[model samples]
Target: MENGTMPSYFYFTLFKDFVHMRYLILILTLTVYLAILLFNVIILFVVFKERSLHEPMYIRISCLSVNDLYGSAGFFPRLMVDLLFDTNTISRTACFVQIFTIYTFAVWEYTILTLMAYDRYVAICNPLKYHKIMNSKVTALYMALASLYAVFSMGLAIFFSARLPLCGTDIARLHCSNWSVVRLSCGNSTLNNNIIGFFVSATTVFLPAFFILYTYVRILIICQKISKEFRGKALQTCIPHIISFVNYSIASFCDIALSRYDSDKFKFVALFFSVGFLVIPPFLNPLIYGLNLPEIRKNIACLFQRSKVGHFPK
Candidate 1:
């Protein structure tokens, strides 16, 4: 708790309530985690195995599945361990790693979604040029750039956070976060934590959001002028992306609100917001895309049929 000294570990004060329902909570989260893994793996296998799904849009969807797996890995494993063993302490190194993984996952989610929006725009707006513009090399470059940007932005934020001299060892939430650690700093962290943090958040979250909005508006305008059947097809393709974006935005807002406001008076609501950010997106992305997209649904059906046929008694 000293200004010049740092704590070796952070104790999550929120886990005190888990003592009574630890087993039940563990079972539920484990089930959800297993489902997340299964759903996303199915999507990835379908996309990769089916050469027809090698297009940019499906590639972006696959990236989302991979990111969901990555983000879930950062949260569920540690959470289950804490619940199972009745431990709330996390080593400083492990805490920061979790923050990086979770934060980067958030950044990648938006970036990948933004890329998907762009792919949809080009497809709907300039159908003839879609393949030319979003070729394999271009898609790879977009992903690489997004990944590097997420790393640099989140890395800078984490680096600044890791250097702060801590005044406390207790985090109020179930997990460690950059803002939570910033709040524990003994000195003013406004410049690095808030100012630069705001810039990072804007680029990773807000800017991409605005860009997606812009693309959708343009697509809408284009759709209006096109034939009704074409318009319906275009909108149908965009429906899943729009749903995913809105769902993620709400979840992200809950997390931000939970971090910025004092929610001690509403512990249940606070807990919902805290865990929902990690849980909802990974749990839903695969289902949203899988069920909505005809190709994915067809491919998945074929996969299961093949499995059934292979196992049939000859």
Candidate 2:
């Protein structure tokens, strides 16, 4: 080293390594997230435009897709920016807002999946009364209730998490999460952590998973008595919900575990699962529902063709 200068080789080597991997991760995240966003937008448009997709199942699917869109959109973009710039600083207010939005959408997603399970249970367990039971009014009420519950629960979680007075500004992760942020507080966080942990596990993990499993068991029992055609259709209808539920459950556990621990190894594992859960389900959802369902597939193809021709070519 010359004249108080640092070692060039060390700094340069680290910089090179970081630049290489950072670019790769950034590109990959952008491509995956943007592709999913584009597909989701297409699905939303198709559902809005096609009168045929106004049924209860598609309605629920649409809501779930929208939640996925918002959920991933909340955190991924910020992560991408931080990765590229090596800047992880976020304002306290911004952090709280992010926590609120992410938590709300996450809870909403779990609630939606639970409702979908109930939807399937009704459609399969009582085919004759499915229409009468899942009428628009009842469905609307369920949606409204789910939305309200998610908002209040997430609000309470945020309130408790935010109350811990900050001793310092250091955060370990790319973005502010309730757990990471709460660790910085000067006040006792045991109660806050317990409350958040309980609510998150109960609603997102236990309740939804239980309902899904119960519904599927009922579905299987019902399938044994129905015709082959009906059984096959019923199984297909439940497949997407099963996939979403499993993804959510795994991700929820990984996140809760990550929040509980401060180890770098655990954080890395948790990050992988968190991103996987967020991205995989959203990408899989359209393929599961749209590709398998004839109406949605046709509408998507038609929509693409019409877009290419530019509105009847004047």
Predicted structure with the largest TM-score when compared to the true one: 1
Please list the Cα RMSD from the true structure of every candidate, rounded to 1 decimal place: 2.0, 7.0
Which prediction has the highest lDDT against the true structure? 1
Q: Rate the local accuracy (lDDT) of all candidates.
A: 0.91, 0.74
* Residue-by-residue lDDT tens digits, candidate 2, 73-177: 887887787678865466667787877877777778788888899999999998899999998889999989878878787778778766665555555455556
Candidate 2 residues lying further than 4 Å off, grouped into runs, are 1-20, 266-268, 305-314
In the range 1-314, model 1's lDDT, one tens digit per residue, is 33545789999877786578889989999999999999999999999999999888998999999999999999999999999999999999999999999999999999999999999999999999998999989989988998999999999999989988888888878877899988888866546688878999999999999999999999999998999999999998999999999999999998997888776677668777887879999999999999999999999988888888785212
Model 1, 197: alpha-carbon shift in Å? 0.7
TM-score of 2: 0.86
TM-score of every model?
Answer: 0.96, 0.86
**Clash pairs, model 1 backbone:** none
